[model samples]
Target chain A: MNIANKANRLTPYVFMAPAAIILAVALLYPIGYMIYASFLDWSPSQRIGEADFVGLRNYVNLMHDAAFRESFWVTVKFAAVVVTLEMFIGVGLALLLDRNIKGMSFLRTIFILPMMIAPIVVGLMWRYMYHPTVGIFNRTLKDWGFEGIPWLSDSTWAFVAVVMADVWQWTPFIFILSLAAMQSLPRSALEAAEIDGASDMQKVIHIKLPLMLPVLIVTLMLRLIDAFKVLEVIMVLTNGGPGLSTEIVAMRIFRTAQEFQELGEAAAMSNTLLMVLMALTIGMFAYNKMQEGRAAKMQAMAAKGTA
Target chain B: MPKIVLEGLVKRYGSFEVLHGIDLEMEEDEFTVFVGPSGCGKSTTLRMIAGLESVTEGEIYIDGKPVSQLEPKARDLAMVFQDYALYPHMNVAKNMSFALRLQRMPKAEIDAKISAVAETLGLTDFLHRKPGELSGGQRQRVAMGRALTRDSSTFLFDEPLSNLDAKLRGQMRAELALMSQRVKKNMIYVTHDQIEAMTLADRIVVMNGGYIQQQGSPEELFKNPANKFVAGFLGMPPMNFLDGEITEKSGEIFVQGQGFSVKLSHQKAEAARAHSGRSVTLGVRPSDLVYDPAAAEDQSLLVSIIVSEYIGAQTVLLCDCGGQKVEVELKSTIPIDRNGQLRFAINPEGVHLFDKKTEIAL
Candidate 1:
């Protein structure tokens, strides 16, 4: 009987073993390899076994590297700007569309179409759109008797163009998630708010936004993490042109390993990017844990009442 | 408090008409309850008055002002939803003071009002807890406290206690009665529970299929329901409906059905006399049938007990009268033979006759 009970308790772990093995092999292995590689003075020409061990040398060098510092700041700015614009535009669109109107479902489908496109395709599409004389944007401007703006040739314009393309592609993700959250909100509370003399704006502020905060926070963290590592769209559009203005950290890391062939520095840069994203992921999880902990405490009290 | 009137209020979703046309005048400071079964439009009517659902083809007048096109905020009211729609993120005090805060009231006044309502609702202890942290009963009280703090001229309740357990529902029903008395504001409560409607309503409006079947004082409606639906909808164990035909034995009128014949009371006989020899339904409450072994055949039904439900003090017996089903509510002390047949006399005053086709009281 004792053996059987032990076997019963082990059933769930036995079933979970396959997934655990796959996760270790597919995910943790690379991450461990990357962390080890970040500490070595390695190059593309030499095998990892032949590389010399360097303790925090790559990290120490990155601290003084002017190009690395510039790219880091650019990555932060791009993530901050794009995430902020996407959040506002996405949540605003969700609020506007969360209503009953003719052809609304079709409209919502159209809104999310940008997010469904491949990142490479989105980059190529926007690059053509941002072409100085031949692109749609400048062509339209010239047609209206205005000077054609050099979208990708100027530093500020290149950054702006990349930011625009990033916003266009990812804003739909935030919009769809926020719309689901907004649609699932307790409808009767809104009705009660209406009866409580709340205007439309007041209801959104006092009730809807507060209820949707959890989903919005999680969505924001996910967007920020994705925004920091964005490469294809910006690479296709600007390719770090106009003096590293649009060179995000991911692009820098790619060029460092490919063109410069400094594998150790690239790994260090990737690890640094991973650490930043890890902090955000941890913050998101901490928020979720706090919410769940409160809910569980309340639920335990409710169970006590019933018992 | 303002007098509320709904004139030809109609609600239609596409071509499907849910509420046909309802005309009602609710007096000031009245606790009027709209009671009906599910899909009977009692909630839809109340939601229309609350301005949640738009009036399709008519006008709602509050204090002689047309309000069909007005926003819900323009209607001076407070509503407690069936789900107790307290802001999940807000504490009890904040939930209660949400509307007052929106009005930009002074902090001290808002605090005072919230404390007063919390004290009355017994929510003072849980004032700092969010709705999620409170138990169901506490959340219900907080919802009530929120409405009370509003001090709106009209208070709307949409099956507010139907979500609670039976014992909690009884407690909340009593509290609601006390609150209505203390506030003396116009209260419109909607529920499918007949007991809640009977106990809490000063005036009960029984609705069915989008029409007001009957509306009057609780006692008046209980004594005389306008039709078959209202009669069955507003009573416990429901009024037993037996198909029969009205007939005259010399000058006295009687209602004859499959297993029994019952003499009509003098008042009902006159009405039955007009519709003599016509098919009708004999409606009797479960309370109207009394255990009596020595009653005359014309005044009693001979029925064999089928199932005996023992519900402390009272034993409800489902019986078969000939081939038709009839339910009887009896005292537990009453000696009943479960396998054998018995006789139960019908109270003359409790007999209700209705037209077979129209189901309208004759």
Candidate 2:
């Protein structure tokens, strides 16, 4: 009987062993290798064992390098601006379209089409649209008797062009999630608010937005994480040009490994980006836990009161 | 208090009409209940009056002003929904004080009103809890408290107690009666439960198939239902309906059915003489049938017992009067053997006759 009891306790771990082994081999091993490789001076021409050991030299060099600092600032700015714009536009569109008009389902399907396209495909599509004189934007400008402006040749215009493209691609994700959230809200509460003498603006400000905060917060975090790792579209557009003005950190890390041939430095840059995303994910989980804890405590007090 | 009136009110969804030209007048501080079956448009009428539904072809007047085109907030009324639509995120106090805060009332006055309403409803102890944290009964009280604190000229309840258990519903029904008496406001309630209508209504408007069948005081409606549907809808265990024919035999009026023949009283005979040899229906309440073995033949019915349901204080027996089923409410002490026939004497005053074709009282 004692042996049977021990076997019963070990059953769950025995079942979980295969998944744990696959995770170690597929995911954790590469990450561990990257962290170790960040501390060496290495190149693609030599094996990892032949590389010289360097203690924190790559990180110190990154702090003093102006180009690296500029790329890091650009990445931060790009994520902040794109996430904010996507949230506002997405939530606004959801509110505007939450009614039973004719062909509403068809309109909603078209709205989410931008999000379903492949990222590389979206980059290619926008690259054609932003072409210098042959592009639709410049052609329309010239047809209206105005001078055709450079879309990708100027540094400031390239940054603006990339931000607009990112916004166009990702805003639909927030819109769909928020529309589902709005539809699932307690409908009777909204009717009650209408009977409570609330105006149109007041109802949206007080009831609709406050109730949608949880889904909105998680959507913001997800979009921010995706924004930091953006590289495909910018790579196809200007290749980090007009002289490094739009070189986001991900593109810089790619160039460092492929073009500059500094494999160890590139690994260090990737590690830094990973840490920032980790902090954001942890903050989201902590907020969710705090909400759940408060709910559970209220339930306990209610049970005690009833008892 | 306001005198509310619905004049020729009509509601339609696209081409299909729901309420057919309803006309009603509620005096100051009257508790009127609209009772009907499902799809009977009782709730639709209440919602039209509350401005939640648009009136397609009529006018609603509050204190003698046409207000059908107005918004719900501009109607100056409070409503308690069937689902207890309390805000899930707001605490009990905030949910109750939401309307007052929107009006921009003084903070001190709002606090005082919230406390007073909460204390009356026995919700003071759970003032800080959200709707999710409270039990079902407490959430119901909070919904009531929210309506009470609004101080509107009228209060509307749309089947508020139908969601509670049987025991809790009885308790809340009594509390609603007491509250209606305490607060002298024009109250309109809607429910499918006849017992709730009979207990809480000063005037009951019985509806069926999107039309008002009858409207009167409970005692008047019970004694004299305008039609057969009203008669069957407003009583517990329902009034028994038996098909019969009116006949004149030896200068007396009689209604004869399959298994039995009953003589009418002098007053009823005189009134029923005009419709002699006409097909008719006999309506009798279960309470009017007494278990009397020595009753006269023309005044009683002989039936074979089928099932005896043993409820405390009374035993309800399901019996067959010839080919039709009939129910009788009997005292538990009545010596009734399981397999034999029994005689139930009918009260002459309790016999209700209706025209077979029209289903209207004769």
Query: Which predicted model would earn the best DockQ?
Result: 1
Weakest 10 consecutive residues of candidate 2 chain A by summed lDDT = A298-307
**Model 1 fnat?**
0.74
Instruction: Give a tens-digit lDDT track for model 1, residues B1-362.
Output: 99999999899998889998999999999999999889999999999999999889989999999998999878888999999998988988999999999999999999999988888888778788778777788888988898888888999999999889999999999989988989989999999999999999988999889889999998888888888888888788988989999999989898998988898878888777888899998999999999999998888889998899999999999999977889999999988788888999999889988889999998
- Cα displacement (Å) at residue B39, model 1: 0.2
Candidate 1 chain A: 10-residue stretch with minimal lDDT: A298-307
lDDT of 1 at B245: 92
User: Which segments of model 1 are wrong by more than 4 Å?
Assistant: A1-18, A302-307
Off by over 4 Å in 2: A1-22, A302-307
For model 2, residues A203-300, the per-residue Cα lDDT tens digits are: 78878898899889989998999999999988988788889988999999999999999988998888888999899999999989988898898788
**DockQ metric, candidate 2:** 0.55
DockQ (C-alpha based) per candidate is: 0.70, 0.55
